[model samples]
Target: MRIRSVVDVKTSLGESPVWDVEQQRLYWVDSMDGRVFRAAADGTGLETWDVRRKIGSLALTANGDGAVVALDDGLYRFDFAADRVELLAAPEKDVPSNRLNDGKADSRGRFVVGSMDTLEASPSGRLYRLDPDGSLHVLDDGITCSNGPCWSPDESTFYFADTWTGDIWAYDYDIATGNATNRRVFATVDTADGGACDGMTVDADGFLWQAHVYGGKIHRYAPDGTLDRTLDMPVRKVTSVMFGGVDLDVLFVTSMARPPLPRFPEDGPQRGALFAVDGLGVHGLPAHRFGA
Candidate 1:
């Protein structure tokens, strides 16, 4: 496979990467900078928006008019044309130490997001679902840092990660009611392989692609939770992954540029830049839009 950095811009703490097939654009966030960005598949015609608060993730609206974003303490709707951000819900308003982290939209258009303890020391974070009706529901709890929220192709299984704990979970998902149940450990990140699991996406063939934050690698896992293969990246802070391109056959990755951690201080010069991996002989499922 061929790998290369796609964007000139870098981020302090880049996290989520969402691909919009209709617009042929990629949307992502620099969590620490509270900035949202979009660009063409090849990184041209870039645009950015500042929400003035830490943004964990964002999802395209079904109508393509705006995005539903997980910013700091709550979920908000951002209107691209009007340049306005309206709060949708603050389910954790009472928990000052937590902030919404990774999230994605389900096939039914419900946004599934999770929270993280700011200090990454406690299990105060929780998983939440924001339905299209503007109602919020709690799905799971006892998490320290949340990441890698996605689903299988058939929409029967939900996958999520608790980064601080080095675990990825699989849950039985109900497409009709947007509920995640029967939670169980689907996989765990070997500290030797990576510092932690950050973000993930499932491919068209049902294999899961995971980003190894400190390991500088992207791993593919079979449907049965077995390691299928691993692809090395140039950067050590690989944060997230997605699929985008004219034919949805390219893999887009996001990374971080912040000061190195004590445990894993080494990093590539291209850290914090966006990357594209092509010619993998694999395609991805269509991205789900919020309220679609």
Candidate 2:
């Protein structure tokens, strides 16, 4: 019920927000700045790496030595010790105008990611799934700006958002085969109210909590896509959310400090800082690590 900024670091376009329960650390990305960050649950022991390319998302590897990241060009293996990346796959080599955007690992440990048209002028982006064995499969397409990829508690439903269209879609997910099908609209953000759905996480109770970028709020939706409630935020560009802390009860949120457009106004001083919501009386599922 109480929201407070937990980190002293601010980012240009903060996103992702992944929590590693085993290590008791939180990892996040500053997309526009192409930076990856790690810190303890209390915001101590902070470390950062400049990947030199726009990074869309990050997923922890089971071995804890490296991470799998969605860079502007493709999926790469990020080595924490060496601070370098090795290309894993570039599914969109032909689509030079598009870049990988939002992604997360399924409960089965396969990474699911979506690309976006950098210009936001065409549906040139596509969704991809990277299996642990190093095979990449295209699942969906016709996306302009991709964001918010997560799954339900039962692992039956996969959720993703196309920021340009303001629609969040749900898919019939096959945990065994790592397939996503039966795509349908799960929810839509009324941009007239001033933002698109950016990132999301499902609570332990199966409710979807989404960050409304530019609207400065988080929307909680029931399993059937009914709006359960909304929590206003102090910053306008709330980018993503995750659950962390000792018991995984705290809701960790990331935001953006950069202005939306070239000449647009900037947000408050706390815009790109990481914030934690405590006392929600709810917990969340642990983030799945890359199986390989």
Candidate 3:
């Protein structure tokens, strides 16, 4: 499928493309700048909210009241109407050297986020799950960088990627309990191929679409871990992807820009821009929201 720029925004780190189905808008984050962006399907009505700290990720609340966001230390509740952000938890308050990274809400409505060393010095990252009642649970540890995290359309599989390890892992997910087990490697790609998987989403037919940060492309893989197709992008640092638009048939993508150097020196000015892939003949399931 051909991916073309839908939004002119070029962020230092653009990630987390989530569709607000009811509002008919797209929400995403610029991680390095701690900015949350919202825009209509046609790319107009673009508005930005700067939280003044590095924001890792965010999920819409089930009631559509606000969002639960992962900043430097922990999760917070961001009320768009009031322009307020209240702390939900500071799980890593003691680890000032670490910062939260990619996160998403599970089918059970729990926010699952991961952490990474800010300096990229050691493999000290960790994965956490924030429940509806504001309790945080540590699911795994010792990750260098956390990136992709998405549940299968059937809610039976959980997938995550450790960017530094160049491996994507899958788990047998218990949707009712928010438990992940039977952890196994699902796919592996070298840095030379992509520099690791960044973010992902599953299609209605059970295929996974993954963004490749270093490769300037998006890879579509069957649930069995076989590559089905690839969509070449104009930028190298493709960060995340989600299906949006009226029928959930448009694939919305985000990317990151490399300072001083154009992220897509060969491809010209489309680097770090948001994209929309249409006419792919596939739709996606709705994103799950945080219960609280």
Candidate 4:
């Protein structure tokens, strides 16, 4: 299928694109710019909130009252109506080089977030579970760039990526106990500079759609880790992707403008543009906000 450019956000580091079905808007973050953006499904009504701290990822709460934001150092609740930010947890205050990266809420409404070093130094990032009562549980440790924590459609399996390793790992999840096990390699890419898999989503068909950063494409793989399809992108650093739009058929992609190599050209039309591709009538699960 062909992908189309929906909007030009020109975000320096656009990442974590999530579709809020109830509001008919797409919420995403510009990491380097430190801005949170909400745009209509049709790419209009583009409004931005100037968050002073770097936002890693965001998820709508179960009750739909506000959103849970993965900030630079901690998790916070963001009230859309009031436009306010409140702290939830600060697990790594001592580690100045580490910051929250990608996070999402599980089916049970628990926020799962991961951290990484801003300088990409050592593999010290770890994944944590933020309970409803504000308790943090460390799920895994020794990760370099915690990427995706998307769950399977059945909620029985969880997928995660370590960007520096180019390996996507799968874990069996217990929704009741908030536990993960069976950590196995799900997929791997060859290009070392692709930055591994950044963000991902599980389709209704039980397939995983992953954005290959620096690889310039989104890879669709079957539940058993078989390559199904690849959606080409114009930019080299694709940060994340999610299925949005009215019918959940539009696959929205977020990209970054940063290049690790100094020789890469900076000026390009596709760098910070949001892309949409038809997923052949496939639909996605609506994102659940923290609380109404």
Clashing pairs in 2: none
lDDT string, candidate 2, 10-58, tens digits: 7988999999887899999999899999999889899999999999999
> In candidate 2, how many Å is residue 43 off?
1.0
lDDT of 3 by residue, 108-221 (tens): 889988998876667888889899988888888888778889988888999998876878899898888888888899887657763568899999999999998778888888
At residue 218, give the lDDT of candidate 2. Answer: 88
Question: What TM-scores do the predictions have?
Answer: 0.97, 0.97, 0.94, 0.94
Q: List candidate 1 stretches off by more than 4 Å.
A: 259-266
lDDT of candidate 1 over 48-144, digit per residue (tens): 9889899999998897589999999799999988878999999889999899999999988999999999888899999999999899999999999
Write out the backbone clash pairs for model 1: none
> Model-by-model lDDT, in order?
0.90, 0.89, 0.85, 0.82
- Candidate 3 wrongly placed segments (more than 4 Å): 259-268
Candidate 4: residue 169 lDDT (0-100): 92
On lDDT, the stronger of 2 and 4 is: 2
| Of candidates 4 and 1, the better by TM-score | 1
TM-score: the better of candidates 1 and 3: 1
**Per-prediction RMSD in angstroms?**
1.4, 1.3, 2.2, 1.9
Query: What would the TM-score be for candidate 4 when compared with the true structure?
Result: 0.94
Alpha-carbon error at 206 in model 3, in Å? 1.2
TM-score of 1: 0.97
